[model samples]
Target chain A: MTIKRKILAAILALALPLASPVLASEQAVTFVQNNVSKVLQVLSDPALGDVQKGKLFSEVITQVTDVDVIARFVLGQYAATASTPEFERFARVFRGYALGVYQSELSRFGNEVLEVQSVQERKPGDSVVLTRISGGALSKKSRDVKWRVITIKGTPRVVDIEISGVWLSQHQRAEITGIITKNGGQISAATKMLCSQSKTCTVTG
Target chain B: MALAGCVHPPWRAKSDPLEPMNRAVFAFNTVADKTVLKPIAKTYQTITPKPARKGVRNFLDNLQSPVVFVNDVLQGKPKRAAKTLARFAINTTVGVGGILDVAKAAGIEKHYEDLGQTLAHHGVPSGPYLVLPLFGPSNVRDLAGLGTELAVSPLSFTRFKGKQTFGRVRLALNTMDRRVETLQEMKTIRKNTLDEYVSIRSYYQQLRKDAIADGVVDMDELPDFDLIE
Candidate 1:
């Protein structure tokens, strides 16, 4: 290759990666912003029944959230030890539980609007997007909501959320691990308990 | 960066030196909650109508207003102190001894403050985290704060017949009220978390920090990051 071309290639290699993080950060912010707007719309739609709102919520949650990652993280040590089928079953139920949680919580803020405030890229692939929820009966002033987004295979997905300073996935990890430990380290026990509590999942034998 | 990845947050390591002892106490607390507290809270919920429950909570909250006001003054939050004072006066009178939250209806929202938050506002560091037998999660700083509050509690000094009995009843009702309010959340936590102790500790620390900042997230406390120019 020509000397000029070689130098140009070297500059491109350094600059391209540097530029990618900025782009990824913007992408993360936009991802959260759009999804949050969608959630607010679903919540406020007067014509939609509760079941319809729930269905839309589940769809958005499945698309925007990395439920597989969250399920594994909440499972903790058991994620590595459990059988593949067992892990999958747990993940399936976790999805329903997560959907239920998001739906119920968001329903309370039906009149609120969440506006993206700022974005901070922690690393090349991870970003924290801060948003504010205000103008609702529930939140008379405003509340801070932080979303941790991680790019997975070129698509940004939410990995965790910090609302009122409590990280959802971290809290879930503690809860799931506690249940598993309480029931003699049985994964099935945790699944059965969550199934009963959420009433959104079924434990199949 | 690699070292940072391995290093836990300051709150995780510095605040929880008594993990073993705390875990034991937490277990005892959990058993007590399951066997005694939960049952009582459930019964209370079952028997008490929603309005009655709200009245109980309001009355309890009104009783704590003096402590909250004092702490707000100590923390140099005059606005919050004034609000606390107003809530107390209004609720005690027009609300008929705090059975109704007239102050809240009049746009004066209730806020909580304690000596621990005052100490925090004054830059006192939260020391080791401890799980009390029935109290659940706390830290060294907060435990000291609790001690101070108890020592100077208005209820303790009230000159009235049956004051001692009232205090005991208040304590019992307070415990039951808290348990009742958090019953569903607690059940979900019990069924969900892998480490209840760690979860509760994290929650306690975050909540304390939030309370100290009056629900405002101190930007400095958040993980440092650079904004894209």
Candidate 2:
């Protein structure tokens, strides 16, 4: 049998529910596949207005993605310095920004094929799902995207995405930190800037 | 302060006596990249289709085979020279004058060898790390190697109806092609790295070390500062 078939057989043998604490590679992959499929479907829907689509995208994305964890990570060293309210505010704005980014990226997924190749454990509680994205209109080469899934308690949440060997979280961190540093260590201004530009601004509020 | 009292980072070589001058040149290269090369590369990328760009890259690689073969022989690697000759022959004819990489498809692996690498293989030490204006990182030995390679390149002597202009255009296009390929990655690096110059320096040194070892060195063991971590 092929690897995918073998994996499916193993999952069938286990007969565990999808939300079980025992997150095998198959289960983690299923989480991503299910959400990404929904994203693609939502993106391709012709009837939905931009605002409705944005809200739907944010709702679906927040289910599988760890917004708070990613928000703290993007804050980097600034996270330690932020007040409780400042941290909450930054996280709120960052979540909206991230949702907007996801929505924009979804619009470019026309005719592209995303295949889950394998899932391998990188550390104790973290697994990376390797996916190949090919045949997109903007891409000439097939891109290898790695989704870092972190299981907290029993829920597997996507913490980061790596494309072309560079982590999206790292890029976001650098940009956000650069903005905060430029504004003389004011996270509030950066939060405002991000919120003003995000498509999720109204939805987030 | 006396030179002996000056503290240098572990990555900097004692032979790098002209570091201030080199740093100035490095700064100049950055400005040139930002103002001139980047804009041209962007336009080139926008105008050319992806497949056409690959073809251009292939053609350029095929043109450089003569230099590779000569350097292989100079390094006393008969087997490598033979391989280079075979690759060049197969790629030029079957690969349609090197517009496609059929040799690679046929399991003929590709490798790069230059006069600088040949010199390193022959026990020549890399003297002070030098940053050449527009050309970027180099050392004394590599600079000499580059000069020799330029003189020996067959493309330098090839004459067309507009020979001089043709060579210049070819060189410009080749540089632009290289620039375009790394544009996105370089932007990411620039955005992420705390100090671009120092990061590039460490990364380049590690790269050269690996190249000198013929890619046999353990990548994880490569010299790492904050650039990678």
Candidate 3:
């Protein structure tokens, strides 16, 4: 209620919104950086066998990725119509398939180091972090990778990724929805086909 | 859910009506790539220096510039057409017969325009996807465009000593360069995707869409990534 205190409060209020996005962007960068390092560590651990490395990789993927959001997005219009149980089954298979994908991709860069280059905040809690992977295994050239991270209820999670200009989730959406449409709009049929083909997921009913 | 108003999305319009035949061809191409082309490309990558490989790529791209320039004009992009011309002239001379992309160094960045994009610009529908043996994924419109380009290209008519041999060498180098460039990417796709055929189809369509639009992605087609729950 003093004049100086009132002015100080107004200044703080004005600066909070401006500062929050910067903080969120920084957090998003750190989130991706830490996860990338963890993945690299798991990959390079000589003591860990293939199965152990896979389990660790799956854990890291589950920890950092918003699998539910990705599942719904890739499922497209079918997500709106499917029963909760059916959608849950689809999401389960999708999560496994996605984990396999991330594992296969990350395993290829066994000895590379990922360094966060910059972050672009798209909205209040969403940011795109650009990183480069080079050195160690990648002897010839470095590769640029982009991670799309979003904060949900104070936790940052990765929603998508772009490698070599191809967005992985976007590509999946097109392919999965195409499969559903090809199967005459049968989500179950699409699920069965994807599960069978992936070999990484189990089909229930 | 009401079924009356539901319709397939536009991206879904890129259908593959010839799935069985396409899959057969795809299998053949995959085998050919694994057995023959991949080994040759890998060996080429191992033996050839990076700069030499880059020079070959630059030279191949330069050879296609005339065709790209024609397509740019056909697509009503005069600025791009001019750039193509400028790039050809600069690279052919200062870049040592297009072995180096001096034009790119001078800030005239490269942009690809093909007859397929020109037809798409003129509102021709991309018919059902077709997988060509050895050539990989293409649509009816793009396949036609390829034929047209081959017929109209000046290189097709140029006369020189050992012209037939030179043409074969060029084709071989182009194919090898493409395989070398995509070796890791192809492996990733094969290892990751649920269905290799479907994945390749989706990637090919999206890549063509981007090319037709001159690399400007349609934001509306992109998934919403801002889940704040």
Candidate 4:
């Protein structure tokens, strides 16, 4: 090959890979923005009752969030210790808790004006979509929240939320770890704590 | 998010029997919030610097830590109780009377346990839901539990001269601060809901349930989202 052709090939290789991440991250932003607004509409729908809303919100959560990943993350060190059944139970319970938390806090930002500010590739596998939520005439405060998004098998999902520099996954990890530590490092004890706390968790063993 | 093969029963209880009375009180409270509380909160937000307002909130939270700690113990959550106590001590001293929230910096986030939750933890069912005018959502059990907590809270009965006035001011400020924080959210709900009363009641019920569950929800009911796309 000629020198110019080799140089062109090298530049093309570098530029193509570099440009692809930007495009992927941009798509991630679109995915988050579109899904969040749709969820807000569901929350704001007057035709639906609370139960229906809860059901719809849960669906949205499942689609948008990497619940299984978050579940394992919440277990933290307990994941290594938990039996397969115990781990499965914990995951189920964690998913429910997270969905409820998200549903309850939906209205806080749902009504406000949301703007996607920027999207940055956080690491090799994930992108961060930054957004600003501005309160209307009645509210004076504005908040910035970031969604850590990752693509799994061509589907993008939110794995964490960073509100004011605090990650939701990290917060859950702290809480779960605290429980396990308090219960003397027994995952079952933590499961019992979760089962007692949450009505959704029928698995008590 | 699958409704495939699940057997979790409905978690909601038919707690509100006095819908008519609750609706009336809710209306009254709405009007009061619009005319009185909202304006005051708006003005307070406008006048107060962000840092000072945050400091005020921190201070109030520090004060309430004792209540949270007591409730944590009552709920038999030793970890939460210890964390609450540690947060209180660190915030009180290092946070400079809780004006800075140093404990948060130290990784001790706030643990918000209340007597109502304590009662729920002990299997005391949430009897008929009640909406008190100006105070917002509550159930019979929570209302009773809140009454007891208030009675026991040290901040309720100040010992210094002009104690009654001091207590009243504190209560008013706390209410106003909360109103300010939730002003936008309240406005959104009102704008979005066709029947504000029903929506508020429903939301409150669900919120209380989630709290009782310590934020856990029933995942079985969630539908498939793939069809939407």
Can you write out model 1's per-residue Cα lDDT over A111-151, one digit (the tens) per residue?
Answer: 78788888887788788888988886655677788888888
- Give the docking tier of candidate 1: incorrect
Candidate 2 off by > 4 Å? A1-24, A46-49, A135-141, A182-184, A199-205, B1-54, B61-89, B103-167, B178-229
Off by over 4 Å in 3: A1-23, A117-122, A197-202, B1-58, B65-130, B140-148, B209-221, B225-229
Q: Give the number of the best model, judged by TM-score.
A: 3
Ranking by TM-score: 3, 1, 2, 4
TM-score per candidate for chain A alone:
0.87, 0.76, 0.91, 0.88
Best by DockQ: 3
DockQ each: 0.15, 0.04, 0.22, 0.03
True-structure Cα RMSD, model 1? 8.6
Better candidate by TM-score, 2 or 3: 3
Candidate 1: residue A2 Cα off by (Å) = 38
Residue-level lDDT tens digits of model 2 in A1-205:
6999999988876876543434656667887787766776677677888879878878888887888888887776677788888888888878877776556545656556778987776544566788877775547656566777777667778777655444556556656765676577788866877776754563232
Interface RMSD of 4: 16.6
Two-way DockQ contest, 2 vs 4, winner: 2
**Candidate scoring better on lDDT of 2 and 3:** 3
Q: Which ten residues in a row have the lowest lDDT in candidate 1 chain A?
A: A101-110
Q: By summed lDDT, which 10 consecutive residues of candidate 3 chain B come out lowest?
A: B4-13
